[model samples]
Target: MDSDSRLDLEFAYTTYRDCCRDLYSPYYYCRRPLGHDGVHAAGFGSGRVRWEHRPDHAPHLLS
Candidate 1:
């Protein structure tokens, strides 16, 4: 892949890792980020993460 595409993939993976760490944290219940609906909404309530690749850009996760 090109440099731009590699960068985009790295960024996406970093974001995904950070998100997973935060979502799975035990302290998330008491120290949740702003706008995070409670634990259930942030975790169990959501569907599986889906990654989509666009023809003109890098792949991204669909929330």
Candidate 2:
């Protein structure tokens, strides 16, 4: 990969790691309601998907 692409990936990974760490902090946990299954489900579901594309963007790119 090009240097620009590598730099972008590094920046993204660092941001993602920082965000994930923030989620586990006590301050973050205390703000949310208990038994919120949908919130947990959404986080779990997001990791399972490897790729995603919006239908609106697809048609423009394909043409």
The reply for model 2, stretches above 4 Å from the true place, is 16-63
TM-score: model 1 vs. ground truth? 0.24
Assess every candidate by TM-score: 0.24, 0.24
lDDT of 2 by residue, 1-63 (tens): 963454345334443323222132222211112222222111222231112223453211101
Tell me the lDDT of model 2 at 22. Answer: 16
The lDDT of model 2 is 0.27
Off by over 4 Å in 1: 16-63
The local distance difference test score of each candidate is: 0.32, 0.27
As for candidate 1, its clashing pairs are none
